[model samples]
Target: MGGSYEDAIALLDTRRRVRRPSGALAKDAARDAGLKPEFRVGGEALRGKPGIVGMSGWMEELGHSPADVAALNIIHVAGTKGKGSTCAYIEALLLAHGAATGWPRSVGMYTSPHLLVPQERVRISGTAIDERGFAKYFFEVWERLFDGDTATESQKGERPRYLQLCVLVALHAFIKEGVGAVVLETHHGGEYDATNFVEKPVVTVVTPLGRDHVKQLGPGMKDIAWHKAGILKSGAVAISSAQEEGLEEVLRARAEERGVFGGDVKVVTGTEEPGVQGVKPDVQMGNCAVAVVAVRAFLERMRGEVLSEESVRRGVEGFKWPGRFQVVERGGGRERWWCDGAHNEMSIGVAGRWFVDGLEEGDRARVLVFSQISDSRDTEAVFRCLAESLKGSGVQLVIFTTYDPDQTFSASMSLDQQVATTTLPSLDVYERVWKELHPNAEVRFELQLAEALNLAKRIGEPGAGVDVLVTGSLHLVAGTLWWLGEGVGGAR
Candidate 1:
C-alpha cells in the first residue's frame, strides 16, 4: 500500500522506539503537512537588520493573534554588562516559583552558525524543537502568513531577515505552547530593538552601563545609558544596579519623564555573603543583592502577591551562574581554571580587585589568557587597570593572547603602552600575532588556544596553587569552556 497516515505513524514510532512513544504518529502527521516542530516565521530575511523600527511593519503582516501577543509577559533587559547574569537570576527565580519561561539570548544556544538548523533559535523551556517539528512549524506559519502559492501581498516588498523572523517564531511558539513568561535579551540599543515591539513589559531591568558597543550606541557612558534607558515603560517598575553619579541621574530623569515612579524604581545596594561553595567573593555579594531587589520588585507585582522576604532570600542565595568567576577542576584535580565574561574596563577592574582580595599570601604564579575584538573601546585602559590592580601583589606572570582570527586591528601597542604608563614590571603581555599572521607558523593560531591553556596549567604545581582566568569576550569563554569539557548553560 502507498504511504498512508499509518505508515507515517510507523516511521515516527521507529524514531522514538526507545521512549514511551505515543505522540509519534501525530507528530509525524504534523511534519508531513509541512509543520515543523520549531518555528522560524521569517527565515533568513531578518538577520542583522539595522534597527527594530522596521520590525513593526513586518509583524503586522504576519497576522498573529492580538490576544496571543497581549498574553506575552516580557522582561526586557539592556546594558553594557551584567545583563546576561541578571536575566539568568530572574529566570531561575521565576522557575523556582513555578512559572514556565522562555529566553531569547545571544550566541547560538539551539542552532549552529552557517548551518541549516533554523529551529535552533526557537527553544521551548530550554529545549530546541526537533527537526521534523521545526519543519512542520516553519511551513505551517509560512502558509498561514503567505498562502501556499507564495504570491500575494506577503510577497511584496518582503525581506528575508533572521533576527526579525526569529522573534516572530519565538512569540508564536510561546503563544502555541502557552508559556507564562518570556525573558528577552536585547542585541543592541533597546529603543530600536525588536523585543521593544512587545507591549510595555511588566518589569524592565537595567544592569550597570558602561563604555562598549561604541559603533552603534555612542562613545561615552551617558550616551550609552540613554540608549539602554529607552526600554523603560511608563507606569512600569524599573530596577537597576547602582549607576555612576551622573548616569544614575540621567536614568532617573528618563524614568520620571515616562511617568515611571521614582519610588518604584529601586537601586540594588548593600552586600551579603554569596555563600556559593562556601566561598564568599565580594563581587558575588553585590550581584546577589541586585538580583534579590529585582526579584522582589517582580513578585510584588504578581497577581496574587505570593512573594515573601524569606522566599526571595532563598532564591538569591541559591542562584549559581556559570562563567562569572567560575572555577572548574580538570583532569581529576591536576589542573584548575577560572572563567569570567568580563569584557569592559569596569568589569575587568572589578574582577582584578576580587582576585587581589581573595588571593592567599604566597600563592603560585597568576596567569591571564586574554583576547578581545578590535571594536572594544579602551583596550589599553582595561589592561592598565588590571595591571595596576595587581601591582605589588606578587603575580608572577601575565600572558596576553589573541583569539579572534578576523581581527583587523591589534591592541598590541596598547598593552605595551599600559605597562609603560603604569610602570608595572611584574606584568607581561605576549602577542600570538607573529604566529597567527605567518603562513608557515609552526603552531596554528586557532589550535593555540589549547596550547596556551595547557601551558598555563603546566606552569603551576599542585603545592604552589595557580589561578588561570580566561576572559575578554564571551566567545573566548565559550571556546575555552568547551575545550575543558563543560557545556554552556542556559541563556546567561
Candidate 2:
C-alpha cells in the first residue's frame, strides 16, 4: 500500500524473488504483516522463478504424485541449444512407433520458450492442444494447486513461475489424455528445473551445450553441463551430442554418477551424414544422432525392441521443429526470408555461417532483423557473429527492435502475445556495435514488429538473390512468422 505499482515491481524485481512466477495467490498470501505480496513481482514470477529448488514439493502440492507422472513414458531432453529439435525428433520417433503398436497411440511433447503461441509448449499427437482443452486443464491444475487443502507452500508465499506452471499443466494434460509417451524438455539446466523431478525417464538426452543462460546456469560450458546432466537417472540410458572439447568428459562423469554404465552412455558424432539433401546443412547431425540413439535405447528398454532403421530415419527426417533455420516467402513477395532463433554467440555464428554458405560466395541485398532478450547482455557478441556471417557478402540493411509490437498482438496474431510498452535499450548498445562492425550497412531502429517487416518488404529488391534474415531470438522469429500468417492450427 505504501508504494505505486511500478515501485512494487522494482522492489520485488530487485529482491531475491524466485526466477519464475510463484503461482502464489499474491494478494491473499501473507508476506510480512500488512505488506502485499507484490503483484508486480507475482507477475514476473510467472516468467522467472530465479533459483530452482521448489519443484519437488510443488508437484506434490498440486496433487500430482511421482507415480502420476510415471504413468506416461517420458524422454527428458536437456541442453543449452538444439534441445527443442532433439525433443521433436524423439517425439516423432515415438509417434511413429505408437502408430504401429497398441502400446503408445498418443504422444505428448513439451518444450520450453514457446516459439509463437502459448499452446506450442504442449502438443498432443504432434499438434498443439486446443485452446479450450489447454485452458480447461490449465485452470484445473491451478485450482488443485492453490485451492482448499491443496495449497502449496507457495500459497503461503512461494508461488511457481511460468515454466513450472506450464510443466505441471502439461503433465496434467498428458496424464489425462493417456498419452503413451511424452518428450519433455527442461526449461533451463536439468538439475534444478521442475522437470527434473520426473523421478525416472526411459532415456535422457543432452544436446550440444553452449554459453547461453549465463546468468542462471553460470558462465562456462562446464558449469552449464553440470546442471544439464541432472536429467540422467540411474537405470535410464544417457545420450549426448558431441560437446566442446572437455565437456564430454563432464557429461560422462555425470552419467556414470547417475548409474549409467560405460556402454549405456551414448555419444553421437556428426550423425547427419552426407547426402541428406532436404535438411539444412547447419542442422546438427550430432544432435540427430543423439536423438536416434536415444529413441533406440528407449524402445529396447521399454518395449524390448528397436525401431527399424527405415522407421527411425523417417521419424527423424520428418520431425519439424520450427524457428530454427526456416525459410518463408510472404504472399509471393520478391524477397526470400530465412529465420533462425539463434540468440547466443555459438548459435548465431552457426546461423550466420549458414547464411553465408547459401550465398555461394557472392554478395546480395541482405537484410538482418535482429532482437535479443532484454536480460542477455551479449548483443555485442551477437552482432559480431552476424558480421562474421556476412563478412564476404554485401549487406544492405540491418534493423534493431524489441520483441515488442512493430505488429500489435491481436486475434489475427497470437492473443497471448501480451502487449506491453517496453523499450529496446539494447538496440542503442547494438547500434554502436553495428557501426564498429558494418559501418556501411544502414541500421534503423523501429519500435513495432510490423514496421520492421514492412520496411524490409518495401526496400528489399526482388529477384537477384535478395535475402532477409530474422535471427537473435526465437520470440523474434515466432512474431515474424505470425506476421507472415503462419499461425494456422495444425500438426506442423
Candidate 3:
C-alpha cells in the first residue's frame, strides 16, 4: 500500500493524527514540566526531549553522518517573516551565477508548509522533485526507519514525526542527487528545528523578525529572536535583516556568544543595494536586500569573490514568490485578486496597505476574504488593522471563511458541532471585531474557502471593477489557489 506516491502521502498523513492537548491541560503540563507554557504547538507534548537533540542520531541511522550533512554546504535561514522569499532570492542568485562560476554547484532548496503537495518541499535546481522521485526517496527513508528487521535503535522504538520525516527525505534526496549547495529554511525556529542539525553552514540569515509562532517560539520578541539566531554557529558568516529596535542586539549577542566568523552579526539595511526594477513594495525590498547580502557572503566564502551586481539584478528581476504579494487576474483582468499570506499582526497591515495602494482612482469596489485558524495570533487585532488600512478603499463586502474547500454550512447544526467538524472559530469573533471597526461595511460568513471565493467573485463581477485582497493565513491563500485550479508554480 505504501509503494505508490498516493500511498506514500496516505502513510505520511497517518503520522499527523497526534492529538494536541486542550489549552488547560497543555498549560498545566507545561508548568509541571518546567517548559514555557506556550511550547505545546505540536507533537512536542508527547516527547520527553527537544526534537533537535535526536536529529543527529536519526541522520546517522539514514546512513549520513554529521560531517556528510555539513558537506552539503547549506545556507541556514530563519525568521518570522520573509524567510521563504529570501530563500527564493538566494536560489535565484545561485542559479544566475552558476554559469559564470563554472557551474560547480547544483543548488537545492528545502522549504516547508507546501502550497500544494509534499513534493513541493524539496527542489533541485529550481524544479520540484517529480512524483516518482518523491515516492522513491520517501519509501527508502520510511522502510529504513520503520522496517522491523533492520530498524535502527532510535527508530525501533518510535517513528519520526511528519516534519522530521520530510526533512529526512529532503536530505536523502539532496545527497543522492549530489546537490552541492542547499538553501534551507527553518520550519519553526532555529535552535531546535530539525534542519539545524547541520552543524556547519556556509552562511546563516535571519530575515525581519516579528511575533509569530508565539505558542512554540515566544513569550516576547527577544525570545523569538534568540531562537532564530540559534543557527549562527562558530563557522558560519552571520547576517540579518535590520531587526526591530532591540532585536538586533539579541542577534548580535548570540553571534558573539557562538563565536561566529566575525564575532558579530552584520545587520543589512535594505539600502545596501539599489532597488531592482520589478522589486516594488517596501517589505519585499527588505527581503531582497537581505538575500543580496547573504549571497555575497556565500560567494566570498565559497569562491573568494564578491557577487556581481548583474547577477543580483537578474536574480531579483527573475524572482517569484507566490502568495506573498501575488496578483491574479480573472474575468480577463476586470476582477483583480491580490493574494498574500500575512497572518501575523505586522504583516497584516503591510499587506493591506499594499493592496490599497494598488487601487485605481475611480470608485472601485473592494472585497476582502480573510480567515485565520491559529489561536496563538491576535486575529482581532489583525482585523482592526486591516479595516483601518482599507478605510478609504470602499470595501463593499467582507467574507470570513475556513481553509477547507469542502466545508458546508447548515443552520440546523449546532454551533458546537460546526466548530467540532471544521476549522472555523468557535464563535463569530472575527466578524464581530471587523464590524466594530467598520459598522457600515457588509460582511458574510462562509463555512468553506470555495464558497467564499465564489461569493467574492460574484460580488466583484467583471463589469463592477472590483479588487479583492485575500489574506490572514497561508492555508487560506493556498486553498484559494487550489480551488481556482492554480498550480504552485513560480517563486513559492
Instruction: Order the numbered candidates by TM-score, best leading.
Output: 3, 2, 1
Better of 1 and 2 by TM-score: 2
lDDT of 1 by residue, 1-492 (tens): 123323322332232212222232244543543334342222211122334544555555555644556556666677776666666556555555543222222111211110112353454554456545544555444444445344377563353244555565566666666666666667656655656665566678788788776655665677778778878887667878888878888788778877774544677756542322232465555555666565556656655355444545545554555667777876565455777777777787776676666566665656667666544366666666665565544555445444532111111212112111112111223233322222232221222455567667766865566777677665566556656666423323
* TM-score, per-candidate, Cα-based: 0.69, 0.83, 0.89
Best by TM-score: 3
lDDT of 2 by residue, 148-257 (tens): 46575656455555566778778888988888888999987777677887887878888888877666566667777887997889878888888889998888888878
Models, CA RMSD each: 13.5, 7.6, 5.4
Q: Which residue window of length 10 is worst by lDDT in model 2?
A: 39-48
**What are the lDDT scores of the predictions, listed in order?**
0.55, 0.71, 0.78
Task: Please tell me which predicted candidate would have the highest lDDT against the true structure.
Answer: 3
Per-residue lDDT for 191 in model 3?
77
Give the deviation of candidate 1 from the true structure as CA RMSD: 13.5
